[model samples]
Target: MNTVGVRGYSLELRTRIVALVLGGASPGEAAKHFSVHVDTVKSYLKRHHQNTLHIVAKPTGRRRTVMALHEQQLLAQLETHQDATLQEHADMLETITGLKISYKTVDRVFRRYKITHKKNTGRQRTP
Candidate 1:
């Protein structure tokens, strides 16, 4: 989100504006005190007094997938058993935890976590 052209006014400014308004000072008087436009003062006081202003910043970024502790343990198992095939790992995880993840998903998870796939070390036979 962009916060352009907004001056760094404190919450104290809003509090002072509210105090002035409550003390029978006109909106124009409050605006003159704060050096802001009358409409701006009105808007600020309206928001501050209404108790409906949301000052909290909303959460951003992608939500993480909620994995169980057992799922994490399964991932650790995969890290130790890199020689196992994707299908083998998937089947084993499913059997152990009843979570049915696909072989493609297992491969994707490995890649996503930067876990290298097992490299072939056996000698190749010539045709």
Candidate 2:
């Protein structure tokens, strides 16, 4: 049960485990031989049957709030009001698009587009 990388098991091993299970080897037997959990072996078999098994599983996390349609609008907002805070920009975007978004979400979307905005550190330059 060697991992392909630092994350999940290698695709070849998973396929071999599935084949063993399908070729009359019990899931428990495969699990013992492969040093993997019975549930893991069963999941590979089920996923293989359902055509959803891939080398890596789909990413699991909170989905982004802002999408591609909002990218141009956000860029336009930044160009028009370069001094606006992230929260203010989020509010403006929500009002225009009628979708709830947070300051962090706005920042993430901007970063995804490789757009950097001025950060307000509240430090005035000494003359």
Candidate 3:
């Protein structure tokens, strides 16, 4: 059984597998023919059986902070307070929005926005 990428199967392939099961192909048969795990075929068939088959399954996770309602305000705060450390940024966000967040969250937001505030690590020339 081939499990190539992270999600294992592409959306188009998943849809096709589900369609095959619906068209009276046994899940195991479909799995062998497609070189996919039988369990994976069963999962697709389950969605088909439950009438919840989607060509593109809705993403299943928390939405990104960058897409939050307060994203613009957060970006502006980051821009205006360029020298603030990650902890400071988190505290500032808490103060302004009453939403306390971790320094890691601040770091992740900075990374997502391509904002760089890291101190230079190279040694300076002696005077």
Best by lDDT: 2
Where is model 1 poorest over a 10-residue stretch in terms of lDDT? 1-10
Candidate 3, residues 17-116: lDDT per residue as tens digits? 9888878999889988888898889988887778765644555678665447455666878778766677887888888888877888877877777866
Clash number by candidate, in order: 0, 0, 0
Q: Can you tell me which runs of candidate 2 are displaced by over 4 Å?
A: 1-15, 21-39, 42-63, 118-127
The TM-score, computed over Cα atoms with residue i paired to residue i, of candidate 3 is: 0.57
- The segments of candidate 3 whose C-alpha lies over 4 angstroms from its true place after superposition are 1-29, 32-36, 45-60, 63-67, 122-127
lDDT of each: 0.68, 0.82, 0.74
TM-score of each: 0.39, 0.53, 0.57
- lDDT tens digits, residue span 68-105, model 1: 55457558777687567778888888787777878786
**Total residue pair clashes for candidate 1:** 0
Identify the leading candidate in terms of TM-score: 3
